[model samples]
Target: MNDFDIKMIKKLILKGQWLLSEHALDKLLERNLRIVDVLTSILNGEILEDYPDDPRGHSCLILGKKDNKYIHTVCGFQNKSLVIITSYIPELPKWIDERTRGGKYHE
Candidate 1:
């Protein structure tokens, strides 16, 4: 999205100021994803979509890779901190590529 959002996300990662939502944590565990995997993905990923008008405030979808598999992370801002809304591996029948979904380019 904007430089400020990107900078804040990076800062959150560097300072360990982000937290996973309960639902997000559950999904990670259900999908056998590790916290480090999600973090690494975010640290090295690219923003795929932006939702500045999200009811929860500004947020974005990030696409990242881990172990050759692609991971999608939904990040949002809350109380001056970054929140991991959700994280999951991209699946077929929905995702067309690492940066696309349902025939639409997310980038």
Candidate 2:
């Protein structure tokens, strides 16, 4: 993957405030070292994927982007994180943006 993609992936892994799958985490590990670097930076949190929008669960894939602002990923050795994207709340997606519209409360 390119630097930008790696960066975005890192942002998600470092900032995503949701639950991340161990399987996806494995895929992320295979991505690139730079991606691992970004993940190492935080040392906290993990990647989070689909939720309300994904009723069937199959619709849930890697990480769906609402506006392509920010993606999502997993972190932590145990893989513990939230389902809400905390890194780029305002500029990530409409769902996240609307959920965190107050910039204080989360949806």
- TM-score each candidate: 0.84, 0.24
* Candidate 1 lDDT, 1-107, residue by residue in tens: 33336656877898988888998999999999998999988888888888877787777988887778789999886676789999988876578667767544333
Off by over 4 Å in 1: 1-4, 103-107
Evaluated against the true structure, the overall lDDT of model 1 is 0.81
Predicted structure 2: lDDT: 0.34
Off by over 4 Å in 2: 1-20, 33-51, 56-71, 74-107
Top candidate on TM-score is 1
Candidate 2, poorest ten consecutive residues by summed lDDT: 81-90
Error of 1 at 6 (Å): 2.5
Clashes of each: 0, 8
